[model samples]
Target chain A: MLSPGATIGVLGAGQLARMLALAAARLGFKTHVFAPSADEPAFDVCAARTIAAYDDPDALDAFARAVDVVTYEFENVPAATAEFLDARRPVRPNPRALALTQDRLVEKEFVQGLGVETAPFADVPDAGALARAVAKLGRPSILKTRRLGYDGKGQVAIRGGGDLGALFRALGGAPCILEGFIDFVKEVSVVAARGVDGEFHAYDISENQHENHILAETRAPAAILPETAVRAKEIARRIAEAEDYVGVLAVELFLVKSGRSERLIVNEIAPRVHNSGHWTLDGALTSQFEQHVRAIAGWPLGSTARLGRVTMRNLIGDDAERWPEIAAEDGACLHLYGKREIRAGRKMGHVTRIELE
Target chain B: MLSPGATIGVLGAGQLARMLALAAARLGFKTHVFAPSADEPAFDVCAARTIAAYDDPDALDAFARAVDVVTYEFENVPAATAEFLDARRPVRPNPRALALTQDRLVEKEFVQGLGVETAPFADVPDAGALARAVAKLGRPSILKTRRLGYDGKGQVAIRGGGDLGALFRALGGAPCILEGFIDFVKEVSVVAARGVDGEFHAYDISENQHENHILAETRAPAAILPETAVRAKEIARRIAEAEDYVGVLAVELFLVKSGRSERLIVNEIAPRVHNSGHWTLDGALTSQFEQHVRAIAGWPLGSTARLGRVTMRNLIGDDAERWPEIAAEDGACLHLYGKREIRAGRKMGHVTRIELE
Candidate 1:
């Protein structure tokens, strides 16, 4: 087991990394945040920071030597960067999990191959394949890039009137995947952790809402049936075991209701802490960030029991200006990202309101 | 009112400041830790740090200009240093509070002046005064230095057999106060905060246990009667108002029971976060550290409602080596100060166990 003074190296210095570093500190571990941007939010709270590109070998080597273990806040960590760090130190949740989640097609295939249900998807490498995949998936489908896509970026929806070749050309002809949209009742996620010894623990399911393709809010316990919640956790456990994943991973699922039966279809798998699981920070016995740190450090996972009925609202853009008002609210836990600018659509902070049962 | 992105200048670089900085970061405030030690624990997590002597005017000037407000983790902050910062920026809890709490004689006088009960105390300016004070207070009384005393340091008990002159000389003949020891049922503390507007709030009282004069453990709600709890809170409120305190302050009290009535005698005042209130970090709606940040920022006080029945145990010296075991225990929240060395009696970290009620 990793000792108290062990340092954990984190990639992608954003709000997630910031929270992770705070959690690491709580667990008696120091954090070294490495990111390309100098204006990283995580740098403000971490013990050490390296403002360098992920692909810089010398920087990566030094960081690996400095830290006992490596983890990332974002899934899109470069494959070569993961390998380089893995060679020097244990890269938690493993590089295979990162490689699987970085590509839309591969992630879906991997999930489905594990006997888990996922939205029907097909690879669309070029216009010819796009035309074929569009016919197979039908209308109102999402054509997302196989790599480097997030928050409604690098993707286009195919509706009634849109030329297949033109739509393909608009995306810069990047390797893509076409997925059929699922008619779902609600979006839910399972935030779980797997230890090196294969001990799996999942928090109460979280029901999520999105605005403009970005997470807007989350509510814990998900308002889902107990059996469905159990099934969601099982799905998460199966995936973690299959990938030999260590650290917290969030599986976004679409809860579909058909007559008297409700089923779930996997939407996406985040190889790191997900926005939907932000509610866990205040609503659960142990936060997802802390759980991730424990898993990466080879420590025993903490309790994932829900604290109460909780709602987490993201403070996007200028919403952070209301921080004072939010802080004044009873039972409201406001967490700001410490970002200097409040640009439109930026995730500036989050507020969690918890009501004990 | 201080805005979200403002910087908070903290004096002292111990675990209390480390936890305070962590709490400030949660509220989007950057912390600038100013202390005399380069290897201070708070330096690891703060946004900026300055190492300089407390009496250094140039360093103080630069630090005061950089932060929006000033606060300290320890009450022993030099009166001159507090004055220096107070002149440049507002010092929450104010310099008057520092002056009052730094000297035991002044602290008792201030508390008694507020219609609060305190142990009978007499000033001992010299050996002659010490002998007179001891004669008045009687045997088994405590002769404590008026300033710079903590964790059982700078104090000696006058038992049945001891040379009064030798005891006086042992403390370097410093200005001292002889306090008659009270026969008490329990040692309890009220950790509270007062905002700039004079709005006061107090957490549930915590019953504390000390080993070798250093806090060992604390349990919240104090096992006191409901009426006594109300009375304790009232005492805290009165003291905060009297001092015009604008941050978290801890009032240690001796719960003395007589027949059918229970009364309290003020022990000492910590003009900053107290170790006894550490349970609030995981047990209350808002932690004492966060409450301190809120109060100093001129923000609304957070809810002080306890989340559960909580116990906080300080991990002193080599006790921190049990971090792995503590982290594995269910419902235990481990927090470690990033100190490398584990000298005997040094506080390394703390663990809080909360049982939801």
Candidate 2:
């Protein structure tokens, strides 16, 4: 295990990296943040920061030399950057995990290979393939870019008749996957961490809500049955073990109910700290950020016991304008990301409220 | 109230300042740290740092210009430094609090003036004064410098007979205060905050244990009588109001029990976040650092509800060497200040374990 005073290099300078850096600091570990943006949120709190593009060889080399282990906040970190860092330092959650999750089709296949069920999907590499894929998945399926898609971006919802070639061209003819829609009662996720020793721990399930395709809120100990929660964690554990993941990974699942029976469907995977787990910051014994730090540092996992039932509401866009009122609200824990510009649908911050069970 | 993106200038670059900066960042505020030392712990996490003597006018002016308001980590911030910043920006807890708490005798008198009980104390300006003060306070009394004393420094205990002149010279014959020893059952403190709008909130009393005059351990919701805890908070509220304090303050008290009756004797006042209250970081709804930031920002105070029965043990010097074992210990929340050198009596880190009540 890396010693307490070891330096950690993080490859993103957003709020997730910001909280990860803060958590690393609490463990006597200093963090160096590397991102293209000069004034990202994590820059304000990290010990050192490099403002360079993902493909900058010199910056990546320096970052590797400066840290004992390299980790990242988002899955979209360029493949070449991860490979470069992996060659020098230990890149946690490994480059393979990144490659698997970076492409939606590859990720779905990987899960299916492990005997886990996923939303029915088909590969669409061209406009001609889009028609066949849509026919296989049926109408009302989602055509999403296989690579570099996040927060409901690079997606085209196929409902009624439209120009299939126009839709494929709209996404720049990028490799895509058509995912069949599921009649899920709720969307839930399991944020789990795996140690270098192969030990795995998962937090309680989080029920997620979305607005405009962006995460709106998350309630933890998600109102799912106990058996379903256990099954969801088992699936996440299996995925982590299969990937040889050595840090936090989140598995999003669709909680579907048919009559009186309920089951979980594997939806997607996030290779780092997930927004659905933000409730753990205030509602769990050990926060997901701290857990990720520990796992990447090769330290033992901490307790994932929930403190209570909690709800986390994301403050998006102009929603952050109510921060003053939120601060005044009793028992409401407010967090605001230091983002200067408020663009539409941008996540500005979050507030969590916990009710002890 | 200062807006979320405002920059807060913290005057001392220590663990307290580092924690305050982290908390400020969580609320979308930035922090600039000012300290004389170049490699202080707080510098690693602060948005900016100014390494210069506290009395350097140019550095002080530049720092003031860079921040929205000024607050500090310790009570012994030089009087001139506080005054200089006061002239340029709004200084939380005000300069008067520094003037009052910097002198032990003055603080005792202020507590007494507010109809609160305090240990009997006498001022010693010279050898003659020392003799008279020792006679009035009696043997086993502690003679501490009136200015710049902390963590048992600049203190001499008078037990039995000794050369009075030598004792005076031992302390450099500087102004001092002789406090009569109290036969106390325990040492407890109320970590409280006062908002700019005069709103007051206090956390549950923390029972403190000292090793070599440095805080060794603290357990919240101290074992004192319920009424004693309420009375202790009342005393702190009275003191904060008298000082018109904005930001967190700590009131250390000696819980004395006699004939089944319990009462508290005021021991000392810390105008900033106190070491005894560090457990609030994970054991309370809102940490003391966040409370200080909220109060100084003119924001409403957060809930001070304790999470459970918690114990915090300071990892002094080499005690931090057991971090690996502590990491494996379930539910032990470790907080290590990023200090490289570990010296005897230096507070290197701490571990907190919480048990839900």
Q: Candidate 1, which CAPRI tier? A: medium
Instruction: Give candidate 1 regions above 4 Å deviation.
Output: none
- List, residue by residue over B1-357, the lDDT tens digit for candidate 2: 999889999988989999999899889999999999988888888889999999999999999999999999988888999999999999998999989999888898899999999999998888889888887888899888898888898999999989988987898878988889899999999999999999999999999999999999999889878899899999999999999999999999999999888999999999999999899999999999999999999999999999999999999999988888999999999899989998999999899999997
Candidate 1 on A1-357: residue-level lDDT in tens?
888778999998999999998898887788999999988789989889998998999999999999999999999899999999999999998999999999998999998899899999999999999889988999889999999898889999999987899998889999999999899999999999999899999998999999999999999978988999999999999999999999999999999998968899999899999898888888887999999999989999998888789999999998988987898898899999999999999999999999998
DockQ, structure candidate 2: 0.85
- Estimate, for each residue in B107-167, the C-alpha lDDT of model 1 and write its tens digit: 8989889989999999999988988888898888999999999999999999998888999
lDDT of each: 0.92, 0.93
Interface RMSD (Å) of candidate 1: 1.0
Off by over 4 Å in 2: none
C-alpha RMSD for every candidate:
1.0, 0.9
Q: Provide a comma-separated list of chain B TM-scores, one per candidate.
A: 0.99, 0.99
